[model samples]
Target chain A: MQATLIYGAGDVRVENVPDPVLREPTDAIVRVLRACVCGSDLWPYKSRAATEEGERIGHEFLGVVEDAGSQVSGLRRGDVVVAPFVWSDNTCDFCREGLQTSCRHGGLWGANGVDGGQGEAVRVPQADGTLVKLPVEEDSELLPSLLTLSDVYPTGNHCAVTAGVGPGTTVTVIGDGAVGLMAVLSARRLGAERIILMGRHQGRTDLGRDFGATDVVAERGDEGVEHVRQLTGGDGTHAVLECVGTRQAIETAFAVARDGGTVSRVGAPQYDEVPMGFGEFFRNLTLTGGVAPARAYIEELLPAILDGTLEPGRVFDRTVSLEQVPDGYRAMNDRAALKVLIRP
Target chain B: MQATLIYGAGDVRVENVPDPVLREPTDAIVRVLRACVCGSDLWPYKSRAATEEGERIGHEFLGVVEDAGSQVSGLRRGDVVVAPFVWSDNTCDFCREGLQTSCRHGGLWGANGVDGGQGEAVRVPQADGTLVKLPVEEDSELLPSLLTLSDVYPTGNHCAVTAGVGPGTTVTVIGDGAVGLMAVLSARRLGAERIILMGRHQGRTDLGRDFGATDVVAERGDEGVEHVRQLTGGDGTHAVLECVGTRQAIETAFAVARDGGTVSRVGAPQYDEVPMGFGEFFRNLTLTGGVAPARAYIEELLPAILDGTLEPGRVFDRTVSLEQVPDGYRAMNDRAALKVLIRP
Candidate 1:
């Protein structure tokens, strides 16, 4: 089978790999139909030492269950399913609490000898807990949207939900990445009355406007914060969704947050020492949202996707075949594509 | 009138000052009935540069309305009241959102030209918003508890409330000062089933136990974190109330926080940066709570104090007259008193 691997900086490649086999009773074999590159994948693509053998990559996919272990229940062979970015035993205390990312028995994909989603097939451990059966056909038009249930859309919703974005609330989404645009859509779905999207890219911010952003600020640093505050009548937004993990992005998130509002950062933070000391403390702001528990939110969002009220798949501006994953990575990294879908 | 002043670090004194008078339509002159030394006060007492002319120093106090400005309503001269640590216009958006500490027109006591709570008389800005009328007498035995409603007790409640502490939740309170002990009580009131108080002081932890701390871990740093983990089946607690502002205290708070739990820091965090990057982000933990919006909680907590269901005032282990204001500061600074109540 063919899979994606990163040999070093800017070196994403498709290469032959062993077909997956069920290794545990809780495991199942998933032959991926559609997998996609995540913005987070760019972290390693931009830096990290060169490697001789490369490593497995990708953690978002929807697929057909090629095989199921004996202990797997509620799912079977040939059932189309979506797997969250991380594998978890849904019965663990953290999983039960809807914080599956912290599940004691769970682990990240493409790590510790686990199969990555950007491959022809994956051996999914804790299959019953990690995979959500999709009601759509493998080649359904809704495949793109359903694929996002694996990580992206849910992560956007997590940013809004954790920040308590709701009807009549004003929101500020920081970033113009696929996840940021998805957050704009999610906030609108959650009834945010106004959304201020801070981004420099004209194309991506245009997509953000289509998704629900009422205002767009193309500035950076202090200028962006000032623009957001100006658009919000000088009080800033009720919620700030930080989808960019850079220090400046986090700073802008807190800077443009209204007093008593929430700042939810769904992006994988790239820096340490957050500015949550005194200034933010006095404002009564709540800092939350991290590592979206996609498994827990997949069910809650499926109905909307099934009914066609949500079109998060619009985030995918480009699609590629398994052999062109390197091009996909470059396109995304070079800002030529919002997100690249991979048909394996 | 007489008032407490901080001429420099470790130099506190009581001296004659001009009598306070209403300065605005929203102001009122309060004859302080009781004022208490706060853990936050020690910050300025520890390192701030000396001044030739002393600055007013106290923020926690209950008083009688000596006079109300022409535009002030719902308050009259001689009305016994408790002023929140900060003055706020309750009608502001932030105040309406139950975050009065961030009220648009609010300002801290003893800052700028505002009269300090430790003074015999204080000109309270935004009188109607800052003063909560107390039913108890000036010299009532419940005065101690009623005074805590101004700051300490509500600060504790804010820690628990922001962390989402609730039935069956396990809580860890770092620090055993008056506020930490009050947090133990607050967690119990919020129905937390297990409360682990991390502190080394025998007397303070004893008070913490009395305030419903089910367990006490005297170890510091890593040992304390380990002890807390062992006590909670190696998963740590669901809520961590950080009542000490030092970096070490915050480190312990995060160390003993269970994945997906909340860390609420009510202390005046002395550091500029916080460890809220990748490590805490991956755990899906929520970091919240800052300066307490004490005014918003005073009404909610008063009934329990009035009905004898809560006794937060027990934290006041010593008392002093107006002339002994310097001694009060020294006593609290040296850990000779949990809290020092002042009578002028």
Candidate 2:
């Protein structure tokens, strides 16, 4: 089977790989239908995260169950499904608490000899627990939106929910990437009264406006906070969604949040430490957010996608075949595309 | 008039000072009846937080209204009252949101020319908004407990409340100092099912038990987390109260919390930065806390203190006169007493 692999920094290729087979009583072999390059993938693409020989890439996918192990329940062969970026035995106490990312028996894709999502087929452990079954056909027009349920959309929702972005809340989203745009959509869905999108690119900010951002601030750092505060009548927004994990992004989130407000971040943290003392401590702000529990939120967000009420798939501005996965990475890294969808 | 002053690190003295008088239309002259040394005060006492010429110290006090400015309402001369550690004009939006510590017109005690609470008389800015009047007599036996409402007790309650400690939740409190012990009491008051107090001192842990600690973990860091996990059936506690502002205390608080749990800290943050990446981000944990809005909680906690239902003042194991106030600081610094009460 053809699969995406990264040999080293900036080196992505599609090559033949061994086919997947069910290895556990609760496992299922899933034939990939769609996969995508993620903002996080760029981290490894530009660092030493990739190997000299080769390493399976990607952790987001929508697929069809090709085969199922005996212990798998409520799911069978040929069924369409979405697997969260990480696989977990949903019955664990942590998973039961809606924190599948911290599940005791869970592991990340492409790590510890596990199968990566950007492949022709992959063996999914705890099949019934990790995969959310979709009633729609495998090739439905809603595939892109449903694919988002595997990662980005749920991550954006996590940011909004953690920031307490609800009715009448004034929100500031600190990124113009696909996840940040999705956060605008999620905040709108959650009934936020005002949404501010902060980004440097005019194209992405335009898309953000179409996705429900009432205002856009193209400034960075102190100037960005000033713009947000100016738009908010001198008091900053009530909630801030930090979709960019850089130190400046985090600082902007904190600065633009009103006293007693919250800053929820879902960006993969890039810095080791964040200052929480001095003025930050006395403002009564709440810092809440981490990795999104996509498995926990997918079921809740599925109906919106199926009913056509949400069009998160618009985030995918470009598409590629399995052999062109490298081009997808370059397109996103060079800002030529927001997100790239790959057909297997 | 007399007041406590700190000229330098390890230097505390009781000396004659000018009497306080109403300075603003919204101010009031408060005759302080009781004042106490706080854990946060130790920070300046041990470091260079004090000025060489001497600065007024102490921010916890219960007092009687000695005089009121023309605009002061709802408070009359001779009325007994408790002033929050920080003074604020309650009409601001931040105060209306129950975050008086962040009120637009608020300022910390001993800062920006504001009179500190340790003096014989304090000129309280925003008097009508910052002081909570009491129905009890000026010399009531409840003075000690009522004084706690000025700071530590409310600060502890803030920690418990921010951590979401409530019915059926298991809580772990780091630090056995006055604030930490008060957190145990606060958790119990909030109906926490089990309270674990972490400290190495037998004397403090014993008081912690008396304050409703169901378990005591004498270990620190990784071992402390292990003890808490073992007690919670290897799942960790539902909430953590970080009453010590050290990196180790913050780390332990995060380490012992179950997935989706909260860590609320009220201790003055001693470190500039905290690591929130790596494993911490994926745990789905919420870190929420800062300086306590003591004024916001004073009204709610006053009844309990007045009725003897809450004896937070028991933390003050030693008492001293204005002339012996220096000894109070020495006793607390040397760990000879948990807290020190001073009468002027």
Candidate 3:
């Protein structure tokens, strides 16, 4: 089977890999239909040290169940499904609490011998618990939107939900990436009265407007905060979605939130520490959000995509064949594409 | 008039000071009847550099309205009242949202030329908004408990409320100081099913039990976390009240909380930064809390004190006359008393 692998910095390749097989009583073998390069992948692609051997890559995908073990319930072969970014035994207390990312028996894809999602086929553990069955037919045009349910869309929703973005809330989304755009959509869906997108790229900001951003701030740092405050009548927004992991992005999120507002961040934090004293402590602000529990949100978001009410798939502005996965990464890294979808 | 002043580390004195007078159309002068040394005051008391001049001290007090400015309404001379730790106009957007501590025109006691609460009389800005009228008589025995409404009691309530501690939830409070003990009391008042107090002092833990702690973990750091996990059937508590603002206290709050739980901290943070990457970001945990909006909570809690349903003032284990305020500080600093009440 052909799978995507990263040898080191600037080295992504599609190479032959061993085929997946059912390894546990609750396991299912899934044949990959679609996968994509993520913003986080660029972190390693840009700086990971070179090694002679390549490592399996990718953590988001939708596929068809090719085989299912006896213990797997409510899931069977040939069923279209979406795998959350992390696999969890959903029966754990944490999973029951809708925190599958912190499930006691869960593990990330491409780690500890698990097959990466960007592969021809992969073995999924806790099949019934980790995979959400989709009603859509194979090759449905809704695949891209459904695929987003595996990670980014749910992540954006997590940001909005944690920040308490709801009816009449004025929000500031601090990124122009796919997740940030999705947050605008999620916040609007949650009935936010106004949304300000903070991004410099005209193309992405244009898409942000289409996604429900009522205003845009192209400035950075203090200027960006001032711009958001200006857009919010000098009081700053009631909620801020931090989708960029950089220190500046997080700081901007904090600065642009009103005194009693919240800043929910789903970004993979780049800095090791964040100051929570003095200014932050005195503001009565809430700091929430972490890795999104995609499994918990998939069920809630699937219907919107199936009913054509949401078109998150538009984020996948470019598509590539499995063999061109390297080019997909290069394109996204170079800002030539917003997001790249890979059909296996 | 007389006031408590801090000249330097270990140097507290009762000194003559100018009498407070109404300074603004909205101001009022309150003759303080009771004031107490706070846990946070120890931060400077233990290390402040020596200076020839002294600074006014204390922030928790309740008293009789001595005078009112022309514009002051709803408050009359001789009316008993309690001032929140911070004064706000109440009409500001933040105050309207029940975040009076962040009011646009609010100011903290003992800051920005404001008279400290531990004085014979305090000139309270925004008097009509910052002072909550109490029906109790000036000489009523409820004065001590009512005094707590000025700070510690409301601060504890803030911790419980922010952490979402309520019916059937299990909570862990880190610290055994007056505020932490008050948190245990507040958690019980809010109907928490179980409360755990983490502290090394058996004396404080005993008070914690009386205040409503169901369990006490004397261990520190990792052992303390393990102890809490063991008590909660290895799942950890649903809410954590961090009443000590140290790196270890914050870390323990995170470590002992269940996945998707909340850590609400009211302790003035002594550390500048907290690590929020890797472990923190992967868990769906929430960190919320700040300076308690005592004014926002005073009304709701006042009835309980008046009706004898609460006795938070039991935390004031020692009492001193106004001239002995320096001894009051010394007793608390030396751990000879949990807290000291000063009768001015």
Q: lDDT values of the candidates?
A: 0.91, 0.90, 0.91
Ranking by TM-score: 1, 3, 2
In candidate 2 chain A, what residue range of length 10 has the lowest lDDT sum?
A: A46-55
Per residue, candidate 1 scores C-alpha lDDT tens digits across B1-344 of: 89999888998888999998778988999898899899889889988799899899899998889899888998998899999998999998788989888888999988999988887989999998889899877779999999999899999999999999999999999999999999999999999999999988899999899899999999999999999999989999999999998899988888899988889999988887888889999988888899999989988999999999999999999999999988888899999998999988
Interface RMSD of each: 0.9, 1.2, 1.1
In terms of TM-score, which candidate is stronger, 1 or 3? 1
> Top model by DockQ, which number?
1
Model 2 per-residue lDDT tens digits across residues A46-162: 885556778888999989999999999879889999999999999987789888998989989987888888889888988989999998897799999999999999999999999
Backbone clashes in model 3, listed as residue pairs: none
Off by over 4 Å in 3: none
Q: Give the TM-score of candidate 3.
A: 0.97
The residue pairs found clashing in candidate 2 are none
Every candidate's DockQ is 0.86, 0.78, 0.80
**Quick one: RMSD of model 2?**
1.7
lDDT of 3 by residue, A103-153 (tens): 889999987888888888889988989999999888799999999998989
Q: Interface RMSD (Å) of model 2?
A: 1.2
